[model samples]
Target: MSSSELVRVGIQIICEHLIEVLKEELKRSRKNYREDVDVGGLDPLEDPESYRNHLRMSENQFEELYEKVKSKIEKQNTIMREALPSRLKLQITLRYLATGDTYGTLEALYRVPRCSIGRFVPEVCKAIWEVLEEYIKVSRTNLLNNIYLVHSLT
Candidate 1:
C-alpha cells in the first residue's frame, strides 16, 4: 500500500481507540456521580399518619387521587433508566405543594435530582388539575346556585 494510505489507516485506528476510551471514561464518571438512592423503597404508606403530615392528605385520599391521574402522569421506562413511578411523582408534587419546600430540600429528602423534581412537579400538578377539574367545576356551580337561592329568598 502507498505510504499515504498506510498513514490514513493509522489515523483512523487512533481515532477509534480514542473514541472507545472516551466512552469508558463517560461511563465511569456517570457511575461515580449518579445518586442511586432507592427512593422507591421509602414507602410512605408504611406510616399513614406521617404520610398524612408530610403530604397533607391521608393515604386513601392519595391513592384515590393517584388512580384518577395515574394514566396522565405515568411514564414508560427507557433503556437508560427506569422511569420515576407515577406514585412518586404525585407524592413529590404534593409534598412540594403542602410544605412549599424548595427543590433542593426535596432532592435531599427524596433523593431525586432537583432538576428532575422541578421538571416533573409541574407536569404532575397539571395532571392532577386535569383529573379534578370536573369535580371542582361542579362543586363551584352548586355553591353559586345555593348562594343565589338564599339571596333571592332574603
Candidate 2:
C-alpha cells in the first residue's frame, strides 16, 4: 500500500478504537443510571414524601426547585453524552447537602462515579444558588449598614 493509504488505515484504526471505547463508556453510564439500586430503590417519584427524609425537601418543594433550576442544571446530551437527568442531579445534590455525605457515600447511593458526583454536586449547587439568588441574597445596603454599626461599636 502507498504511504498515504497506510496513514489513512492507521487513522481508521484509531477512530475505531475510540468509537469502541466511547460505546463501552456509554453502556456503563446507561447501566448505572437505569439499573442502580439506590436510584431505583429510592423511587422519589413514586413516594416523594418519603424521599423528603433524605433530601429535606417535600414533594412540592422539590418540584418547585427542580422547575426553577431546570434550565441551569439541564445538560445537552451531545456534549454530556450520558448526562444525568435534571431530577437526578438535583436529588444527588440535595441528598449530599441534607446528609453531609462524602462523594464516595453518594456514589454508593446514586451510582454515579465519585468523580462525577464531585462535579455534579458543585454544578447542581451553583445552579440552585443561582435559581434562589433573588430570594437568598441579602440587601447590600442592610448588610453594609449592619457591618458599619458593628465596626462603630467596636
Candidate 3:
C-alpha cells in the first residue's frame, strides 16, 4: 500500500483498538447498581422547536463524528463476530460510551442490566484514554503553556 493508505489503515486500526480498549477498561470497574441508584434525568439537548440549534455547525460536526465512529464500529463488528457471538454487545457498549445514561436508564432502554452498564462505562473510557494517552495526557508542558497564555491575556 501507499504511505497515505498505510496511514489511513493505521488510523482505522487505532479507532477500532480504542473501542476494544474502552470495553476492556469498562470491565475493570467494580461498581454495581442497587435499587436506590441516584442518577438524575437527562439534560435535554438544546434544539428548539424551530430547529435553529440544529442548523448550527456543531450539528454538522457531530454528524461527521457519528459517521466516522459508525464506520469504525461496523468494521469492528465484523472482526468481533466470532468472538462476541452476540450482535447487540457492541451497539449497547457504544451507546453507553457515547451517551452518559445511568445504568438504570440503559437497562430499560437497551434491555441490559443496570449493573452491567454501570460496570462497563468506565472501562471503555479508560480504554479510549489508554489508546490516546501520549497525545491526551495532561502534561506539565501543557499546564505551563496554558498558565503563560492566561497570564499574558490577563
Candidate 4:
C-alpha cells in the first residue's frame, strides 16, 4: 500500500479500537452504580412474634395468603432487576393497615423508597382483596342463610 493510504488505515483502526474501549468502559461505569439508599435487609416477618405483631396474622396465615395472591402481585423481572418478594410486599401492606403509618415510616423500616411503598401498598392490598373476596362472600352468604333459617322457623 502507499504510505498515505497505510497511515489512513492505521488511524481508522485506532479509532475503531478506541470506540470499543469506550463502550466497555461505559458498561463498567453503569454497573458500578453509586446507590446510597438502604435496601432489602432484615425482613421482620421472619420472626414469628414480629410477624404477628406487625401483620396481625400468623406466619402460616401469611404464607397461605401470600400463596393465593402471589401470582397477581408479582412483577416481571427485567434487565434492571427482580421485584420485591410477595411476602415482603404483603407485610408492608398489612403493617400500613394495622398501624396507619405513613410511607416514610414504612420506608425507614423496610428499606424501600417512600414512593415505592406508596405504589406498592395499594397494589398489594388490591391483590389481597381479590384473593380473599371469594372467602369473604362465602362467609357472608353463610351468615345470611343462618339468619334466614332462624326467622323462617319462627
lDDT of each: 0.77, 0.73, 0.46, 0.71
Model 3: runs farther than 4 Å from truth? 1-94, 137-154
Mark the 10 consecutive residues where model 1 has the least summed lDDT: 145-154
TM-score: model 1 vs. ground truth: 0.66
Error of 3 at 91 (Å): 4.4
Show the lowest summed lDDT stretch of 10 residues, model 3: 78-87
In model 3, the Cα lDDT at residue 40 comes to: 26
lDDT of 2 by residue, 1-154 (tens): 9999999999999999999999999877866654443442257778777888888878788889989999998886643255678888888878876777777777777777777666666677667766777886776467547534532332
Which window of ten consecutive residues has the lowest lDDT sum in model 4? 145-154
lDDT, candidate 1, residue 135? 70
Local accuracy of candidate 1 as per-residue lDDT tens digits, 1-154? 9999999999999999999999999777666543554773246658878888888998789889999999998898654466888888888888877877878888888888888887787678668767888776556566546534532332
TM-score of each model, paired residue for residue: 0.66, 0.61, 0.30, 0.67
**What tens-digit string does per-residue lDDT give for candidate 3 at 1-154?**
9999999999999999999998877654422322234432221165433222322235444344334444333323232222121223334444544554455666776665566555444443344344446767687467547534532332
The reply for model 4, stretches above 4 Å from the true place, is 1-15, 22-38, 41-46, 137-154
**What are the RMSDs of all candidates, in order?**
9.1, 8.6, 20.8, 10.5
Q: Going through the candidates in order, what is the number of backbone clashes in each?
A: 0, 0, 4, 0
Model 4, 1-154: lDDT tens per residue? 9999999999999999999999988766655543443465335447878767777888788778889988988886543445676767878778777887777787888888777776677677667666787766556566546534532332
**Residue-level error in angstroms, candidate 2, position 48:** 3.9
